[model samples]
Target: MKKAWIIWLASTLLLAAALHVAFMFAYPYILMNAAMDRLSANGERENVWTHAPRMTETARLIVRPSPDLAYSSCVYDLSDGPVQISVQPWGDYMSLSLFGANTDNYFTLNDRRMPESGAIVILRTADQAITDEQRAAAFEVVDSPSARGIALVRRLAPSPERFAEAEAARVQEECRALNAE
Candidate 1:
């Protein structure tokens, strides 16, 4: 029955299309969530760096990471309010990127953006409002959309000989939750 075969083929094609569309929309979010879960559960928790020296070895928190770049990640929880981030411009190429739960990069900073002093400080918060005193003290205030997120630090280590220097720089980066005033 050609008619019945045609109906089945069309229905199957439609179902496949629908499934594909759904997966396409949901894949990024799902991937981000899974990465966050592994990151938070890996005992690093919030405000501490989880170093991944060999990026070729597939990390639980990042997909298709590059070995040429050394990585350090910190999960930030804004439930208690603001957090302090400090970076020492110890290398030629270094970057810090903040990503929210929805996989949006809300803020990013690099060595080139740092002051001549070769150090940078950031006050990050998800609070909708801030007092004048707080604003005055903030060197670089970042207003985030979500209460929880991750901060990633990337340092270029093109070869094994350069890895130690990059690792030293990565270790110098500081991320800590500030005590509420």
Candidate 2:
């Protein structure tokens, strides 16, 4: 009876460990899918920037959003083709970050690293071939691990006045499929 009880306890622990590992591996993908669905719910096309209004207590688009920052998000689907992203500099603090389908942030550019003219990047899947035109465009090319992902832009707007400026500057930010135009 003692040996049987010990074996049962060990089996239960192993099952729990496996379950935990599975959840850990799946949670990021699950969260990202939900976010993508929400972002695209309005029949908006992919690779278009969606500028989010300043985070308010009522805003729930993102988990624990900072009320002081202005945010924009783009749900990119590179299956059709590579996408071009352009982020316009705003204020003293601004950043652009790219995350894969699994929520892995593979690239980030901040104001300090960006040029005065702003930053432009082309995102393509590893298997996608870069065209001569694209190569000659003199833009930074990034190989995405997954064909679908998210690009997020953040700008510090700690005050209402600064938030207004951030909102205005966000107009210049853009993301679009390279083949579209």
Please report the candidate that would top lDDT against the real structure: 2
Which residue pairs in model 2 clash with each other? none
Error of 2 at 43 (Å): 6.6
Candidate 2 local lDDT, 1-181, one digit each (tens): 9999999999999999999999999999999988987876643758999988889999988899999888999999998999999888775888999999999999998999888888789899988887888766735899999988899999999899998898888888779988785
Clashing residue pairs in candidate 1 are: none
Query: Could you tell me the lDDT of residue 105 within candidate 1?
Result: 92
Give the C-alpha lDDT of model 1: 0.73
lDDT score of residue 131 within candidate 1: 62
Count clashes in each candidate, considering only residues at least 3 apart in sequence or on different chains.
0, 0
Residue 72 C-alpha lDDT in model 2: 91
- How far residue 153's Cα lies from its native spot in candidate 1, in Å, is 0.8
In order, the Cα lDDT scores of the candidates are 0.73, 0.87
Q: Which candidate achieves the best TM-score against the true structure?
A: 2
Measured on C-alpha atoms, candidate 2 has an lDDT of: 0.87
